[model samples]
Target: MGSSARLRLYMNDNGPLILDGGLATELEAQGAKLQGDPLWSARLLHTNPQAIRDAHHRFLLSGADVITTATYQASITGFIDHLDVSCERARELLMSGVHLAKETAETFVCDARPAGQRCPLVAGSVGPYGAFLHNGSEYTGAYAQEMSIEEFKVWHRPQIDCLAAAGADLLAFETIPSIKEAEALIELLREFPNSQAWLSFSCKDGTCISDGSSFSEAVQMANRCTQLVAVGVNCCSPALVEPLLQSARSLLSPDMSWVVYPNSGEDWDSEQGWLTSEKTSASISELGHTWMKQGAALIGGCCRIGPAHIAELRRELKGSCTSPSSAV
Candidate 1:
């Protein structure tokens, strides 16, 4: 079955499917050094693939319905420049990210998981063009102003092609910062009609996307694409999730689901790293409840949100839903 079909089936049986938290965060907790590496967790695909697999395993064990691959910062150009590998080798490394997640999911089903628990789906991570630049542009969306739509398509095409060919259940065009990139991605989806994807953006506020576009407009753009099964926000503040979902709910069609996976109520600085906020009020579980109430169909965490947070979300969501066992 196709990814959209599988996701629909899962939602029919379960309430809202739980996505895994930050793979890089979990990897770091496990002592994988990612700093100074432009590829971030993608570097583990080559240096320590087992670490990547182990991170996926932890999220699955924590009750995530979907586990994304470690290909978020990976691209052919980036790989060739950083690792000095040929295009073939770069593609192999990109495919390895999906393979690792798939293999881990299979192992969890066959060996570790309890009876009746379903195998988690694997989503190939496709971070924004800004991520490839190794700058903070992903959070700001300023880079999109300089790049044309055709340039965006050209840059993203190979990465999308690589993930689709690798047999990922779906593509996660996550942390998107602009409507132009989202448009480019929606167009690129036509190149792989059999594949389905979820376009989640990085927001500047509750009502606006990272590039200052309204959330309603971004959601409306994604709603027109049949290949996109879900659309909403990720890697933004958890506090913005409620209003963002409200905006998305207003524009999204009933056929399309909304996904929200925000950070752990912390601000990120490129130099200082993640800065905690004493002023932040809502907990991750509380944000999950609000997101569901606002009509989100898929919920999880992003940066600084680890397996423990996912486990808590699983418990919270399962407890609130009518069919708790259906989630597994």
Candidate 2:
């Protein structure tokens, strides 16, 4: 089976997968100064890999069934410029993002998985083209108008290639802000026939994505992709989840699962990635059941969300998200 099918098996047997909260959130709390860094958390992949691993370990202990890599702001060019390395070396750094997450997940599963439970998944994150721009255009997608489809593909292919080649269980094409960019990504996804990915958008409201395209239209596009394991929104306000999912209900494919992980309520900064916000960490767990009821097969938090929130989320979902064990 392809990677997408691997995820389906887990969801089929284990119910909705519990995704991890923010990597940068944990990193910042650990005293890694991230403000004004163009590479964001990806910089740590080179300077302090153990920190990333430790963050993943905490989320795993908190009951995250899936952990995302710190590649959201990573790109070949960015790494080359920042690290002053050869192109090949830059690729290695990019691939290391997957390696670090995979290693951490493997360690967790070995120590924690009971007889019947499936192993937790490591999702290699592929952030939008705007993320590389370092201007927060990911929230607006204004850059899509400046690049051709081929240009967009050229920009994203390397990161996706590195992550897939590095052995992530699935790729997460997340925080996409425009329909055109989504179109490019969906087309690019077909090239890696054996690889599976989940596509998520950054919405401006309940009705449409950030670039003003209808959310329903984006959902239709996502479900048509043969390699997409799930589809929904991420990095937007938690309040938008219901309206976005409800609007897509009529057109959603039953075979296509929903994956929704929103930010903890804050404005996104281009340079900082996420503005410091006062989030009620408990609110994510408080609202998780409603998202599941709305047809989400996978749920978790985004920016500003941390291990405590994930523990609460797991607690709230304890009845359905039991400790993974084959004995069950």
Candidate 3:
């Protein structure tokens, strides 16, 4: 894996890319109560490391080509209030997530029951500042008076650098809601010489993110960075993602790749706070089929989409994409 050789694989790969989700809460379902941290994101890190492996393995079994590490909310800044986990310790947990995924994929390939099929790739997942800030607001002026981009660079450098060191095949900056924030990360990504990455936004009305930037604008900004392999929408309601995909296809270059992984639905209640309704998954899969026809390169489930939803997507994908020309 020399620099030039690795860079070539990142830039030239053509075909559908599969990304997996459901690590934090999914780990909870597997009997791990990650308590002790008020920061919701760090809890997953405190949980059994094996829980991280199992959730990713489920996605791999469901046919995902790329498995994302469970490090979305595993930030040192997010857990400073907690006395138990130090910044360094929290970061190691995040890096461990990446290591576990890559190691798991290697294990699967080596122990393949049917030897011929290949295993999935590992994708390092990065989340926002534990809040709902958009790209522009993420870093600009007085809001972060206590911290500068240099400080952020110091905090995130370890997490991102560790992922690079842990053998992540790609980096997935997901659920990004603003062009400003996306650009901030794009700038950091340029520092990584040969690593491939994807940027995904969470839209509101199909055209605008929660911060109010047009979806097309987000694509234009992301495209400015040459290292980006794909731009997409994730963590928004299923209804919003469809029109966003359609709008995105019209603006993006056909040679570029597209990915979509919408939430089950928008409604949330006490019992299932932020959970996607069961019916939404089936409908989202139906919409995913149409998106595949329009130019989406990859498809999968995000929040609330369990194995059953992935099963539906896989089944639909069988007939949804028939020719390479149809995939964008």
Summing lDDT over every window of 10 consecutive residues in candidate 1, give the lowest-scoring window.
319-328
How much does each candidate deviate from the true structure in C-alpha RMSD? 2.8, 3.1, 5.9
Local accuracy by lDDT, each model: 0.86, 0.85, 0.64
> Would you list the clashing residue pairs of candidate 3?
135-180, 135-181
lDDT-best of 1 and 2: 1
lDDT of 1 by residue, 184-247 (tens): 9899899899998899999998799999999999988898998888998998888888888876
Best candidate (score: TM-score): 1
Candidate 1 wrong stretches, greater than 4 Å:
2-4, 320-328
- Give the runs in model 3 whose Cα sits over 4 Å from its true position: 1-15, 34-42, 79-83, 113-116, 131-155, 269-272, 275-282, 319-328
**Residue 181 alpha-carbon offset, candidate 1, angstroms:** 0.9
Count of residue pairs whose backbone atoms collide, per candidate? 0, 6, 2
lDDT of 2 at 97: 89
The C-alpha TM-scores of every prediction are 0.95, 0.92, 0.81
Query: What lDDT tens digits, residue by residue, belong to model 3 across residues 22-109?
Result: 5655665666664333444345555566767777767666556667887766555554445367877766766787888888777765
